[model samples]
Target chain A: MRNELNRVVMRFPSKSINEGLARSGAAAFASQLDPTLDELGDIRTAVSEAVTNAIVHGYKDEIGEVIMTMKLFEGDEIEIVISDKGCGIPDIDQARQPLYTTGGAERSGMGFTIMESFMDSLKIKSAEGKGTTVTMRKRLNTRRYR
Target chain B: MKLIHDMKGGLLTVRLEGELDHHCAMDITARICELIDALLPPRVRLDCSKMPFTDSSGIAVVMRSARAAQGIDSRFTVAGLCAQPMKVLRAAGVDRLVEIEEEVHI
Candidate 1:
């Protein structure tokens, strides 16, 4: 049996807006534990949504760095922290709403919703001038390797 | 994903083989849109039998595809959705927007 992997960190500038990079990073990180496609998809979606939110909403077309940190805990749960040093959400409540969008035409405001739906647990912190950080947790029950 | 189309009849069927996440959502969406616009299909069927997992981005892509089909006056139906994808669609209230075919035994 392979030992559970600990953590991975990746950083990308907001100007690039490459979805492939984020998803590939997620797949590679989760593949270390030999998770099933179902588990992998769940983690991939959460990471994608988080990275997208950081790029589109937090950075808001401005150039900044978005960092993603992923760590597996106790051979069962995965914790992920995605952060961006950009414009933060003034009103976190309104931002978390299902379809409430600050962006006029570019964003759909579904990033947080998708992240919450895919991950087991999600927490967000942001300040007016400071940046935003999103911490998400996902549990892996089955030991299937694929 | 394997997409089969009957151009003369204006019918397109898409068989999704694996998970539909951000990795494949854009590609699938672009392909579906191109086919629908190019052929002007009367109806489109999305077969999700083999698709075990789909994320919210996948749902967004599906919504976009459905909207594109509607814009062209084409009917779109999603069929053979298993547990995971079905739950995600239901949670997102996508069934109300698109016609989803339930399990049918032949």
Candidate 2:
């Protein structure tokens, strides 16, 4: 792990409405790194996907606590970890596949795919009936002179 | 998010305003599907010009809307998407399912 410059930990309810709050909050915090507009959008979208997964898939039919930790490292790197203490995923491999959703018809099952594509790296850890944690990292290459 | 719909000459255009995410996806899908079923237009256009932000949930909304239109043999199109939403749609291969017209800048 690189030397951490800053960090923030947020704990919120697994309410559907908090999805927006989580993403926007992450984006706002990341703005300090002077990310480009496109980079900010990617970070926001990735955070949204991970948070949505915690709310919808992790705690299906119930409300649980969701924890999000944002860390800023040297060299404009941002690492985000979203975890839920809801029902853990049975198969992380199948769950990561594109268009493979246990979330039924309304879910596109593209959450992990989006997070993987938008971020630099994605890591998932889960144990069935225990919980799930998603960690994503991205390094923003802004041309701004420091 | 705000959804505005209008039907003209068998074509229905629904413009989405504000961020589209899991919070509002169910309502948006419901409203769009209801309009499609009620009007049964020959062509449906989802105007995403004002919708600047979205995640995978937006993809589900588009997919469900397209399915609704397809059920009635209606052509569905998504137009004027911003960069982020467009990337998501393409990432999910939704562009293959529906016609897409990116925002044009002069």
Per-model TM-score on C-alpha atoms: 0.74, 0.96
lDDT of 2 by residue, B1-106 (tens): 9999989999999999999998899999999999999999999999999999999999999999999999999999899999999999999999998889665221
Model 2 chain A weakest 10-residue run by lDDT = A137-146
lDDT score of residue A43 within candidate 2: 94
Candidate 1, CAPRI quality class derived from DockQ: incorrect
**Tens digits of per-residue lDDT for model 2, A1-146:** 78999999999999989988998789888999888889999999999999989888999989999999999998889999999988999999999999899886668999999999999999999998989999999999966753
DockQ of each: 0.20, 0.84
lDDT by candidate, in order shown: 0.75, 0.92
- The C-alpha stretches of model 1 lying farther than 4 A from their native spots are A1-5, A15-17, A103-108, A142-146, B1-6, B13-39, B46-54, B79-87, B101-106
Most TM-score-accurate candidate? 2
Every candidate's CA RMSD:
4.8, 1.9
Q: How many steric overlaps are in each model, in order?
A: 0, 0
Which ten residues in a row are the worst by lDDT in model 1 chain A? A102-111
Model 1: colliding residue pairs: none
